[model samples]
Target: MTSAPPTTEPWAAPHARGPVQAAVSLPGSKSLTNRALVLAALAEGPSVVRRALRSRDTLLMAGALTALGARVETATDDWTVEPAPLVGGGSVDCGLAGTVTRFVPPVAGLADGPVAFDGDPGMRTRPVGEVLTALRALGVRIDGDRLPFTVHGTGSLRGGRVVLDASGSSQFVSALLLAGARFEEGLDLLHDGKALPSQPHIDMTVAMLRGHGVEVDDGEPARWRVAPGPILAVDQSIEPDLSNAAAFLALAATTGGRVTVRDWPAQTTQAGDAIRDLLGRMGCSVLRDELGLTVTGSDRIKGIDVDLHEVGELTPVVAALCALADGPSYLRGIAHIRGHETDRIAALATELRGLGADVTELADGLELRPATLHGGLFRSYADHRMAHAAAVLGSAVEGVRVDDVAATSKTFPDFPAVWSALLDAR
Candidate 1:
């Protein structure tokens, strides 16, 4: 987390006096960048991840890999990961990153000694027990069930059949599959709980595994078979982070402005890509061309009734948009988000209500009714998505302030600058 220190000073959220016209180029996808780094570290040869996101979460991942004996050169936009003999006796700081907490343990299980893992004070509540318990069932010696645990490896793991509940997060599924190819007997993972969240994230994991020359059989529902073999190294270029572009695009959707996000991929498995359809349903004009993707707001922002179980990360910003709508909205099927960086549903309800919106926090989602919005202090809860949500409402609601705008650097390093630039757009 090389971002600026968290401050007590509240940042006044910029308001759009009129329609905004802006075009901005976003950074690389953190999801893709972290996954690429892990795979490259486990590959048979050196791998290059071009245009990787140099944010807090991704940097934590790179650091974890380095702690486990991989040489990760992140000095440039392109990061080169050199695979070395897996050793242990290292400690990894998870740093409030769900990816780091979930993804690194499997890799740590292949090291020669004991590797310790811990994260931010807030990450204590997040779930890593599912992954840790599953790794134990797959023949890895683990000291604890959650963060602040240690993986005692004998330089290998006996991975085979393991079934556990992954309903809480898709990262658990991805964590196992990423290192399954290196397991001695390979891996057969099954989900024996409720429905999984973020199916696209799991799909993304599968695609990346295949791209790295690892064989994965996900032909059956809720079941994946990974065949043990050498992971092939491949040079790769990352797609722009559409998720980070959400708050920026929200500026247009709220103010009848026009915003273009540069280098939007024509096809993607990114969950953030769903924002186009989401915004469109809210009466925003969406167009995709060689210039990239553009979203223009309508005279009125309409409330939507939609299920966000597959795209829970977008909940905060979507909830903010719902707060700005003239009508009511029902966002459901995302109860799993209770386990995110913060309890997002509760945080949204508290913050929105504080900002003078009619908000009802439900067990699975939220119910937002139209109300006149006013500005108060909007706190970010040390969660980047929370900060993005604050900015969304603040754009229309006057006198909005964010407690810690630097929290945006978790994935979007240039967020403050980009936001100022967006407001300056005419």
Candidate 2:
């Protein structure tokens, strides 16, 4: 097992005033990168992936593919994957990446060997039973309900109608879709009564599948039918992550400064675009150019009530921005956050309170009042999002210290360096 990275303390002095200009080549989307890795591993021949994210999440996915018999090599910014027949199956450690932990197992079900999937403590707690149950229905062998779980691949998986409960995370549904091509008859997926929280993420999954030459029939009420076929390999570039874009967007709101993010795609299915509308309602001047986006902070931000069901992952960042607003902000429709890398709702509330914000954790979401934030040491709880959220909030307050800054490696490995660049540009 690889050792976790060293922890660091992240502290930020309040920005006095300035316009921030930066041309950043943001890392590739971890979500897309992982999905592509899985699909490429399942493809027939060699596939070239350009500008693949090298962050911890994608690294775990790549390593898992290597464990599954795919030969992976890196050359400069591109990763070349030569798919091999699944010969030897062994244990795959997913580290702290929930995407890799949940999504990898289902793809492994199509292999010929018994693959044991496990992860870091955080990934172990995330629910994989939904995918496991679906795989079992498709004639795959699954052992137990928790990590260190084993999947005995049957070489061929049969397609069946499955009603998925995806409220917790969309990765389960995406995983099934990626592996659908190998199934004998393919799959027809139906969503349970619970509403799909992050529809855009699901859309992104489908889009990437299509790019990989897999055909999916997207129907109404969240029904999808994937045909069993070979996935055609192609050279593809991953788009900028909207989730990563949120932190910099919040920077503008926190400092009353102007910051621009370059190389951001104009069109994206990522749910994090909710930040634009959400921030606009919060009284920030957000402008998008052909190159990227520019957000100018307002002198006084006004809070608004909103539901973040589709963009639940952005809840913490939104809550942090709301703390600097003029009035109380109400955010709902994110009850599933409790099951993420950490109990995000409770963790955010605790850390925000530590920064002197009046925050209440509701069953589904949170209510935050605009209060002066005092910089103090904040805990990351070993969660990357928690660490990034605390660091972004710390930029708005004096003397803010974020413990375990290294946790950001899970998604953006160069978070501290990126934040430093943004600060320097200001």
* The best candidate in terms of lDDT: 1
* Candidate 2 worst ten-residue window by lDDT: 1-10
Indicate the TM-score of model 2: 0.95
lDDT of 2 by residue, 306-366 (tens): 9988888888788878887889999999887888888888888888898899989899989
Q: Please, what is the whole-model Cα lDDT of each candidate in the order they appear?
A: 0.92, 0.80
State the lDDT of candidate 1 residue by residue for 89-202, as single tens digits: 999999989999999999999999999999887887789899999998988899988778999988999899999899999999999999999999999999989999999999
Clashing pairs in 2: none
| lDDT, model 1 | 0.92
Model 1 residue runs over 4 Å out of place are 1-6
Residue-pair clashes per candidate, as listed? 0, 0
TM-score of each: 0.98, 0.95
